[model samples]
Target: MKSFRLDELEAERAANDGAYLQFLRERNMSVGLYALDAGESDRQQPHGQDEVYFVVSGRASITVGTETTEVARGGVVYVPAGVPHKFHHISEDLRVLVVFSPPES
Candidate 1:
């Protein structure tokens, strides 16, 4: 078993409006910590595996396949494999845990 502190991961530098850290990954799954500074919206990506997002702090707007949900602290979202999703219009200082199964390439 492996464990880590979320704050230690490399902060992903951005020219855009958010920051993230790809903190931990294993053979079957990967985990990340994400933060949105400002103007964070309209992010659409096709995922290769099932995903679970747990809000560590702050708020988020998560979208999956035409459905949208507003998630706040302690909120969680489950996205199935091959589903297209996005994080939209989030202006709050957000810290979220993103887990992906069968680790993407």
Candidate 2:
């Protein structure tokens, strides 16, 4: 069996310059930590794989397709494959736990 700690993953991500840090990957799914600074922009495009985001901390607004909603700690959002989505209007540093099905290319 394998295990991980969120604090450790977050620390690793903080040491990197990229906004996204992947911690685990398998044949069926992948997990990572995604962070966005306050007032920062999310320059991500639509993915080929379905994705899930669990807000670990902070607050922001996410636009998925034509809809936009506020997201904060303990919030969960899902985006289907090929759907346009991004985070904006960040009022605080946003940290999210990201999961992708069938891995991410």
Candidate 3:
């Protein structure tokens, strides 16, 4: 069994100066923390695997396919494989827990 602490992961990510820090990876899925500061842009492109995003904290708007909506703490979102998605208009620092099925090839 394995456990993780969000604060620890966040600190690691910040120390690495990276926007995302992958914490767990297995045969079925992968988990990571994604951070975006206010006025920053999410430059991610479409992925080959489905994904789920849990907003750990902050406020922003995400666009999946042609749909767009606001998200904040406790907000959850799902994106299907091959769909274009990105977060924008961040009003606060965004910390999102990202889950990708099939290990995010």
Candidate 4:
């Protein structure tokens, strides 16, 4: 079993590129913490693996392909493999938990 405290992870901001912090790695999945400050943009492209995003805090509009929606804390979003996605119009400092299935190479 593995455990992590969000506060501790947030405190490690210096080690991160203000984008993501990969916290766990397993045989078939990987978990990462992603954060974007207010007004910052998510410049990620399509992924090779399916992914799930759990919003930890803040608000933003996420675009997946041609669909876009606003998400806040406690909200969840899913993106299938090979789909284009990104977050924008961040109204607050956003913190999210990202999970990738089948592990990412």
Candidate 3 CA-lDDT value: 0.97
My TM-score estimates for the predictions, one after another, are 0.79, 0.96, 0.98, 0.94
Number of the top candidate by TM-score?
A: 3
Q: By lDDT, is 1 or 4 better?
A: 4
Please provide, for model 1 over 31-96, each residue's C-alpha lDDT reduced to its tens digit, 9 standing for 90 to 100. 877676446664547888898888877776888888999988899999998888887767676777
Q: How well does candidate 1 match the true structure in TM-score terms? A: 0.79
List model 2 lDDT by residue over 1-105, tens digit each: 889888888788888878999988999999899999999999999999999999999999999999999999999999999999999999999999999997986
Predicted candidate 4, C-alpha RMSD = 1.1
Clashing pairs in 1: none
lDDT (10s digit) by residue, model 3, range 15-97: 99999999999999999999999999899999999999999999999999999999999999999999999999999999999
In candidate 3, which residue ranges exceed 4 Å CA deviation?
none
Error of 3 at 21 (Å): 0.4
Per-residue accuracy of model 4 over 17-59 as CA lDDT, tens digit each: 5688888889999998899999997888899999999999999
